[model samples]
Target: MLPVGHFAGPMFIAPDAVEPESYEVRYEDGVFSLSAAEYAVWALAHGDPDRVGSHRPTRQALTAEAEATGVTEPAVTIDALISDGLLALIEDEPAARRAFAERHQLMPLALGLGNQPSQLGVFQIGMPNTPRVSVGYDIYHMWLFCHRERTLWAAVQEIAGEAQEANDAAPAGDVELIADVDDLLAGLIEALPILLSTSCGFLDPRRPSPTSAPADDAAGSGDDGRGEDPAEDHEHGGDALVAQP
Candidate 1:
């Protein structure tokens, strides 16, 4: 349990779906779906409690949320979000800084500064029920040159490019193939940020979840041959890159 005495403390939210009505948080390889009110309570950690319009972790804030959402018990909702790992108590600003720092490695990769997979670079991330990305090579596995090591952005661009190329080879006005191309393109674009973050250890390693199992059975499962091929659905099956949301 996090001690809430420190007003300056902030916590980390997992790589989650921050939707208006609900939140899907992936932590320790498990997916937690939070109610709107609960999500509101958890969102308090994103900023200062004393800030205007930002959420504050307190009974008064809970009352207002309860009145707005009709949850009837905001305290219970808050407790549930806290315990479920969708929201965490960051302890202090220093800890908060470290948590945020860990996520910084993602920006560079997301902005198209990455390398190709000369050797297979497999990155399996996201919780089981949330967004999961599995990247691998079908064949031609060799040592990847440091200048061309696989990066999330590069992989997405590569697979998506191949898919586009396939669609181009298809006859003109081929609506089905074109639509499939669009889905692959859109999926890859959506997957870029999340995959990059996952590669950079998007989840705070310090915050352990009770529902989580050994990492060998969790996110690590992404690299295993037993898992489904991420790029199997793509028409151009030359590359193995898949992202699911």
Candidate 2:
């Protein structure tokens, strides 16, 4: 079965600014008018917006649903969306784990502090080419952990280990700090889109290629013959002014 994966980046449907009948789609760095077929397929694929991270619908199921909804050329639309990078495909959990182990791949984007850095070391984190969001300390720590550990599961394990170590080192009477593995993993998965929405992170796919460059360099290759702002050359769209809000 071909399992559909959650979008690696941010995608939201909102009212179109000009067209009353059409909808606006904010995907990655570009804003485009949404098509009925696209919306239908997307809605069918993402049954519940809140649980998209854990959900992986098969292409066939989505196509059948789309056909039921009267979406013309359902298969075509689904394939197009996947090709456009708005959707992805993975074989299964075991396959994903194997690929991840071999590649140690995770987020392909970079994180940066928002315009206003907090005085309490709680700076807002986001991307340079998109609006920055205040994702709080925990989210920031998770991103840092992923960056250091090179994978989400590994990061969670490392954090859990640290919590255990902290509790072990505490005095006999002191309260033990607890880090629930399931809760931490769930929270991280939930916050992933927010991180991706900021354009500060993305899911790294498994493929035959050279090792990745540094995140900072990936964000903006100052020299190296590439443009000053790497966001300018994004595959999906051009550079967008980072919203100050």
Candidate 3:
């Protein structure tokens, strides 16, 4: 008998989404859209495929769970997701644990902050015991956590490797290291879309909250103190002024 599996890795969830009536999942070139009813079953059983055997729920049980979440789908999305490799069923508990740990062998060598570039963090979504995240900042550092960290880094390395021939023309010494660093940054930039979808950008404790509402003074900039609409007053059109840097 084929055992059930959950999502192969973590994916983002909307903070406002409790039990989505419909869900659309996109991975690389693969896009799987789910209706709200179908998605209820999926959401109920998703996350932690490796441990599914320990607490297997019957399709009937899943249907009830879905209905409780306000969904009435008959649980068709489960089979579809398992077939896509988006969810992989691992029957061995110990083996799955080993697989998860051995998957990523690299760690951050150092940590610092700036407007510069590095691998962004990967986030796990809907995982058991893990808090749901919705931070949307594109942090320059690898501060998020995702199941695909090593896979992404490996791809980045291959891309950056293509630039080695150009670096060979320069004098050796530290040039190789510098070039590699440049390549790594370039790779991160290239992988921006992947990171954005798969992970949550982390917020720095030092930085002010980006989501804070604008103050009264800043919000009404260019408007009269009486709260006139600046744009409305300029119906005659305004001149385009270029400012010096």
Candidate 4:
């Protein structure tokens, strides 16, 4: 089975609908049999879907509900639920599942700097000697440049011209020629990842399900292809252009 955090993709089912049967959780050893309700509780508390809230149940609420339902121990029920993947536990009460979804719906892209140009440009432009720009950087600029590269370049040229004129008119070192360079780069970086992630087919489309086989057996029938590792193929299949900032 895939490791817990390795499957960080969004849950395909709604939080309420994530019962144990919704997934097929298996163990490498032969000692566990988790029910649907149990799986649902466990997933809510421990799976990637539960990361936003860490799946912690409210103690007081759980106690009250358990008492009303005639259950002797609410904690035991909660533990059972966790084992089955039905519920989750989080550190902060304010960051429950609902709140977590509200706060962190998207996966953070590899880009680290802020979205502003002053922050993003230093990485996008690079040294100019490389043939292909970093995929990550190019993806951002390409999105911003969509149907407007010429116009954008023209604007940059105009700005550069203005900067040049200011430098010529002023005393030496008076004009900072690279003043707007930061902004220019940021604009490009801001848009690249959105474009690439959405359009470039770099990310896997399949939901990370436990039932999924490691590889497509039909496609890898021949000896030469059969010996190759599926995991390595998946990792290196794309040209993930890495740019050094």
Candidate 5:
């Protein structure tokens, strides 16, 4: 069992907390966007949601793992994981363990199907009584963890190897095509959210009406006592302005 107060950490992050960094993976015209940290968290949560219930390790254990993995700071890593929606804090150890296992099993399968490499690799850390998912790597330096089982890392490495093999089997022609298509697709992807937002009325740049206006007054309307229409001010005349003598 985890220590007495290990589960007492904050359940939810504050709104002002740092946002996860996002990455876009483009294939042809379709683009999938996710944060690096989120990808890590997803691997964890998808594999096992129950893992969050385990007793957290001492600061020393975390520090040792971080140093070995080049993480330098455990808090930053934890924050990034939480921000990515991969992991969560829960009060129940059994539930957390189950969740963590589920996440571990699912993540490799998902990545394998998508034909992408699994960057994060699982590792165990800390004392035997209260072992935890220590920071570790796979092909890349991405961190991974599985709190429920000590053998999870070994399984993850095997799965990662399979994923790498699948990714490697693509034809050279297909690779070039994907590369060319992704380059063209990038500009469209970056512009898409802005385009959609503008298309929707919700993101209009117009200002809100003052509180002095009637409750029914729409946003951006003028406040003249004479009830001059604000919409009329937006009308454009074809002729340029000219000075009169």
Candidate 6:
């Protein structure tokens, strides 16, 4: 069974004009018209839909929020949303590392870094068919690992190493860099479904190709399939390894 942390995928929700207290939610290719009670449950689970990542809510928290909002049988409503693919229940970080990331290759659909320093490395990443999303620096850095021929865990280690090197001047402290990296990895795992569904990215079973060439070699290397941006116009089909929430 999937773990308890539930998160909503990329979606847009607006109030329904004809139906009072209802919502019209657009996710991927489908539209969900949610009644007030149902919307209450979903809204509680997904705070600030405009944010790039999904809101991670525990089951108990979701139920309590639903009850507070006067939604009856809140669990039933939450389950319905899960079944409808509007919400994905993510596994805890440890389990996700074992089951998802370690087993799948995170292939980007389109990834570009922000040009301005004020943007803090965040970028508008997109898939062939899905809307672009604002991804933060940490997540963006992690995604960059996809270009290299290494496991996601290896990428985490690399990131942690970089952090360690940057702080080398400071005396050794109790900070556990791996733990911090794991926390960031958890966010990526939680966002996996939305990433996969939108075709903004995918988790491949096959081994990744060699690390991409440097920017200077990009122009002429186009003839070599290895030079293509993984995110551009790549075909997306078949069943998703990760289930939609």
Tens-digit per-residue lDDT, 1-245, candidate 2: 12122232233345553322322333323333335455456545544334434553567766776777777777876777675444555443554534433333345355556435335445566455554555554556666656555445666667767777888899999766446655555555556544544445554422222265433233212232333321222223211111110
Output the better candidate (4/5) by lDDT. 4
Question: All candidates' TM-scores?
Answer: 0.29, 0.42, 0.29, 0.21, 0.20, 0.42
- Residue-level error in angstroms, candidate 6, position 213: 27
Clashing residue pairs, candidate 1? none
Q: Compared with the true structure, what per-residue lDDT tens digits does model 4 show for residues 1-245?
A: 00111122222346575322222332211112333222223232221221212322344554453444344444664665443222333333322422222211122223333244655433432223421223343334333332222223333334445556776788876634532533543443333233222222111111222444434422111132323221212111111111110
Instruction: Give residue 43's lDDT in candidate 3 (0 to 100).
Output: 50
lDDT of 6 by residue, 1-245 (tens): 12212223432335553333334444322234555565556555543334324444567766775676677787887787675544555566586575454434465666553435776455656643443666665666666665363456556656767766756645767443333666766766766544543445654332333565423332112233322221122222221112232
Model 1 TM-score relative to the real fold: 0.29
For model 2, what is the error of residue 68's alpha carbon versus the real structure, in angstroms, after optimal superposition? 16
Q: How much RMSD separates candidate 5 from the native structure? A: 24.1
Tens digit per residue, CA lDDT, model 3, 1-245: 11121122222357774443233433222234444433345555432233333434444555565556665334444455454332333333444423322322112211222221442333333234542332222222233322224333443344345446556765766334223533453333333222222322210001112354322322122222223221121112111111110
Flag the better candidate by TM-score, 3 or 5: 3
- Which lDDT tens digits does candidate 5 get at residues 1-245? 11100111121236674432232322111222333332222222222213332423333443343444333344565554343222344333444433332332111101211111453343333234443233222311112122212222333344445445655786665422122222222322222122222111001112232454433443222232213222122212122111110
Better by TM-score, candidate 2 or 1: 2
Weakest ten-residue segment in model 1 by summed lDDT: 138-147
Query: For each predicted model, how many residue pairs clash, with residues at least 3 apart or on different chains?
Result: 0, 0, 7, 33, 24, 4
True-structure lDDT of candidate 1: 0.33
lDDT of each: 0.33, 0.48, 0.33, 0.31, 0.27, 0.50
